[model samples]
Target: MGSEAKGLALSAVDPRAAAAGLTPGLPLAEARGQVPGLVSLQADPAGDRAALTRLASWCGRYSPWTAPDGEHDQEGAAGAMIDASGCAHLFGGEAAMLADLVARLERLGFTARAAMAETPGAAWAVARFATTAATPWRIVPPGALRRALAPLPPAALRIGAAEAETLHRLGLRSIGELETIPTAALAARLGRGVARRLDQALGRLEDPIDPLRHRTPLEVRRGFGEPIGRREDLAAAIESLAAALCRRLEESGEGARRLMLVLHRVDGTLQEVTLGTSRATRDPAHLKRLFAERLDGLDPGFGVEIMTLAARAAESLTARQTGFMRERDRTVDLSGLPELVDRLESRLGAGMVTRPRACESYLPERAVAAAPPFVTAYPAAFAKGPPRPLRLLDRPQPIEATALLPDYPPVQYRWRRLLHRVSKADGPERIAPEWWREIAAGATARDYFRIESEEGRRSWLFRAQGRWYLHGAFA
Candidate 1:
């Protein structure tokens, strides 16, 4: 249930509730009046989002480019968007694919409605508003989007609530009626959003789907006349596929970070092997070596007839000039580091290798974070300021200190049951909290001090809100 202008209201309802004259957005009291024993539970938006994400991931079996569509106007109904541009033939055809998708969803106890068209906008409209009880799915042929979408309501255009209400008041109930009005006149009447959405639905504008998982466009495949099950043959095929893929990446000035090898067995079963690199690269030999470490124990069910290699993730890479001198320069060459990391991760596992990266934060603890080795972007440069301690405490330790002045370094301090007299002191560098962060109430600036005790032990101390704390130690 969710709060409405009137009171607690139903955010969703099953078909039975709808048959009893109950609908989403209906007040809970009124819904109970309609059905005496209506059962309800509080809404979990986060859980719903997570469920939708999982559903989108599950749909990846159909197409790699899939994402959860939770912004549809259909009451209590969520959807997923799939870009099946080149994937239809794998499942026989578009019609067969759609039928199979719906059948699988129904078997999973979900009341599903699916549609296919030239554009996502039209498909979304037809799936939710155009399907009938006899047929819960529809496929609008190419160039038939306008004809199919004409009979749908204006709400199917994905306009705002106020816009739909305004369209209703203007006597423009159906999409056909709205299309009759000129573009300029419609924009003057309802704004550009309506016109843009209309154009998107009619395929005049481009609407691309941002996939849940990024899949690289560079790919190469090999089909054998006779199925080969030998490990040596498979290894050779991987080398050839890797070479072809690398050629394509070099042509596009890109490099792959992640690669997926799909082995299609003659028995209709598929075996997949995935590998990730520490940095983007287009070296076919390197890619082959990386895959060699992961191809062991792969089951070649009846026989593998088709092998497709796809670069699942990629990044832009350009050639760099090397020094003209034959002798090695004094500057350190970290180019081999990425290759080392790739081999280690390939043997160990993805995400098992990491490195520290600087972050954009003023807080000492938040200034650095762990990140994947050899990330594409360069690390942020540290600000030139006072030197930070070599080692920082996990959490600042409280200490009793006495200072001659309110804003000066401590003359003496007691920490961990030990007392020390300050022999030398450096600063009271004041650092203010980041303004953009959501700081707690009464949060104040910190005054840091670098001091050496009589025993020659150097420490970093900070004072906040009149309380002194030992934050770090110098080596």
Candidate 2:
């Protein structure tokens, strides 16, 4: 029953409930009175829809074009549509694939019912309303939709409850009853929706199902006559596939950002692994090394027969030449950094390593930002200003100090209950506050000094107004 036991109705029922003379949409209280041990659970439409989507994704092993069948009604459960047109032969034949699909689903604890026809509408109708309890699957041969749908009810034409009731009152109960009527007259009397659905089922009109995922354009595959199980053989095959993919990318002047490896087992199972790069790349050797880190986790279940490599994401790339000797000597070459990042991410994870970037800000902490280590066109250069410390405190630590009058540097200070006497000191370098338009308070100037203590340690100190604070320390 529902939370407050208020107007509770049956959303669905199992075969046991049907055996006990109880149907869906009946009052829960009345059902309990009729059947002594009736069990009722609240409706979960969203959860059912999510499960349908997951089922659709899992069905991709059979065919890439798969979609969820319609939304679940109060009494009906949801289903998935798999367009196994050109893919059924891979698993022996259409009949074999259908039996395999149903058997696997049954093993997974789903009382699944499936059907296949030349038209989507006919398949949907036959799966739901035509098949009996003993015969759960119905396969209509090509050009047989007309004969297959003749015995089903008018509701199998995808009509609503009100439209089905209207048809029943007019004595047009079965789909065969409408076959003799003229199309225009039938549409004019019952409705256009009924005529449209009927035409689609009988192969007179087109009704296509949209797949949840689009096939990647940059994909290459190879099917072997015999299944391969050895790791060495798999590695060689991967190297060849990567080389071929890189050649294709080179021809198009593009580099891959993400690559997916799909292995089709001889038993019709699929295993997939994805690799990502920090930057666009077309190098076959580098791509192979990235996959090497994760090769141990990939299981060749029952031996793999068909292997495919697809570049899921890519970007245009341009060729470049090395700089002159003098220019190269002055700059550190970072060409190997991207490969290192790919290796680290392959072992640890993506986004686990980051570098600080320079933002256009005057505030010391805000000036540098940490970001994922994606390759940029230009490298960040050190800003031309007062020398920054090796490490900066989270916030400036307040200290007690005395200094000469005016803008002189401090000679002695006490920080964290420790006294330090200055032996050598630099001049006070004035630093102005951030712009007035920044909407920040304490827009006062600071006098910074580089001081050396008697123990020979260097520290960065700044004075705002009459108070001194230790901001950072030198290495």
Candidate 3:
């Protein structure tokens, strides 16, 4: 790697040796010896990836469908791909988005190149190889990919190293040279991924994006000027925006399921906070209260000048059209759901906190799991079964024991350290395994046991394959 890697060990003279001339896969010692003035230090991949993820998250303001492209971040590489198909216009059009993206990256002290195209391949090539100033971050103009990628070597298409070496040997260095070659030969040598990438970049094939952001009903946002210097000023601005957005919802008889507030500082940094409600709601007071909980965290280091409020996962707002006579008179309180989700999500990460979900497996361990994170938008479920356990272990632990009634609780048990004596015991609740999903299809049956020890400690235990383990304690 080069001195541009920030901490990669270099010759202590020139900081751009690797970025300037040395190639990847070359020994750093050799690279340093060759480039006399190289200055470098060791690079941290973890830090680079984390920094890129943060930048990618910040880029979510422009397009929620953005995702980090690669896992490795040794040096000279770190970026995200934004799926801008349906999101470009939301940012005041593509040209504005490009300018904003560039300006934001510059403020963050990053060298960035943004490109817009009909396909990811085209956008990737343009962003990686084209002249730094392409317009419209989401819309790909005709022939733009061709003009943008022609000068770069065929390796820009991300073809394998061997194929690049072959191209170099055959005097076909630029992408234009490889493009002129017959497709059959390239396909025979490089396999399908290469030809596909080339065709996709040239816009000759249909390449649909699997967006990072799933399709939701709507998550609309509105921004305001006049820096909100005080909490009251920011709150007032938010209430006004919420009221305006609620008007749009009221017209369609709909309401927001979740609301997000984004405060963009004058220094190009962004602070975003989200609130979820139990039921669909448009109450400005409730919304103000929710945002107020996390308001202090939104520090405006350079003074926030732009405030954006977005309403997400909209639901039909039920209203008493005629208090005494209306079909929608009995409205389901959806606001409560978001309120709980917001509170729990605030303490734990959106992924860590989730609702119990009924899983479709007979194995007790596989019968339940957490719902997808931050998604309060699942449709109703109709699966019904016996009451599930209030307490379940993430994984079952093995125990040594001896049973008395063959189908009763363990008379003596041993696990981890000490042995236990079961003075009282309950019958076994027979449970079966999901043999169909078994890797080798030889799983045994399980029997649940609820036991009370002489010490008055009650435990809900289970036995499988001649083993007894305490799964949960009745407190």
Candidate 4:
């Protein structure tokens, strides 16, 4: 038996329990007396709330705006709300979308009933009470909200239970009956709730829904009369969406960094494909290339009926000069390098392509680090520093060396079991140990040199603590 502080009561019940005359909050002892061999389990309100949040997120395929309905504490949630205003046309129509939403939830082992109206209050009321064979899921058409809500009880107007009972005793059984009474008379008795709820449901007052996710501003969607299943047709749809998105970006002077594609299948499933660019781009051709790498992975199960393209992240893009001078046009521009890097990263994972960035550290390995390729901003270190080696060692290798003087360049050195006699050498360039490092107390300053061996092979070597180390090789 499920136990609580109130003493062995049912916290929740299923259809079978309800059919057997067992209801929630019923004493377990009485439940067992009424129906022999009754069983119960502990309730998990927190887990239920968490599941509701996830379900709200998954509802984004229908609308970007979805919020959990009803106030919740430790008791769990009531339900969820989806704002399918502009989204319904994509799934065929308002009635079709409502039916599809309920059917899909039922397939996922959930009992769901959905209603769409111009007002949230009317939708909520119609969803709970309005039952008709012609419309499986309720949909109150515009200008017909009052007629649709006339049959529902005053309790369906979201009034308090006690208030509903009081109104019922006063013979105000239906919303239409309540509407006939004057506002002042109803407020004198029912305390303004009846009038407020009636006004909210009949579109006399505004009702706003707070969404769980942020809605992207740059989104374009297209719906088809018939479902499309061909790969070439999907490609054409994507290309068309990219072009439309570029036009929108151009009007706003913004470019996309990350983009997402949502394909709504006829079978009520959603297939998503996402791609990112190395640089903010408004070029439709470039955007197509990035999405092309992952387009093959999409499965248009039962055909796709609607497709949406959205820019998830964007940045300001300034206009660039397209027409080049005759003489200057001969010089090749490296501005297109970012596109190349984006293509490589898209084809072979983002980690595969990286750039070397200079860090604020004295140690050779710590001084330079590998980072993602930069497109918009370039580091100041590359512009002001002296020339570095073409290739640097992961860590400096120790070597045996002899120098002409104590603090001078190395005259000769042996590295990796090979001896090299220095024919020419440059003066020592000193680098101090970083004061913040833990090893700074015992660390000595490094004196670096550019040395050319007898074979004219140039190398960068540094000396610290009376030991020589090969740091890099010059090309």
Q: Which model scores highest in lDDT? A: 1
Clashing pairs in 1: none
TM-score of 1: 0.60
Q: Report RMSD (Å) for each prediction in the order shown.
A: 9.4, 5.1, 9.7, 5.8
The TM-score measured for candidate 2 stands at 0.75
User: At residue 298, what lDDT does model 3 achieve?
Assistant: 66
Model 1, position 94: C-alpha lDDT score: 91
Candidate 2 per-residue C-alpha lDDT over 375-412 given as tens digits, one digit per residue, 9 for 90 to 100: 34334655898788888888888898889786888889
Per-residue accuracy of model 3 over 346-430 as CA lDDT, tens digit each: 5554555655666777776776678743343443442665434557666776778887566767887776777778898775777
Candidate 2: segments with Cα more than 4 A from true spot: 1-6, 70-74, 133-135, 176-210, 217-255, 260-274, 282-285, 295-310, 320-337, 352-357, 370-376, 379-383, 393-409, 413-418, 424-448, 463-470
Worst 10 residues of 3 by lDDT: 6-15
Cα displacement (angstroms), candidate 3, residue 15, comes to: 7.5
* Candidate with best TM-score: 2
Overall lDDT per candidate, in order of appearance: 0.84, 0.79, 0.66, 0.79
Candidate 1 structure lDDT: 0.84
lDDT of 1 by residue, 1-475 (tens): 8887888999988888888888888899988988999999998878988888777765665676789998755476888999988988877799988987787678667898999999999999999899876788889999899899998999999788789999999989899999999999999989999999999999999988878878657767776878988989999999999999999999988899889887867654567788888778999989988888877867788788778888988888743432222456646565666677888899998888876777877888888888776555646656777989999998989999999999999999998889999999988898888867736666678899999999999999999999999999998
> CA shift at 124, candidate 3, in angstroms?
1.8
Per residue, candidate 4 scores C-alpha lDDT tens digits across 328-440 of 57466757776888899889987688876778776666877777776335444543455567778888889999997898888899988889999988858887788677364
Report clash pairs, candidate 2: none
Model 2 gets an lDDT of 0.79
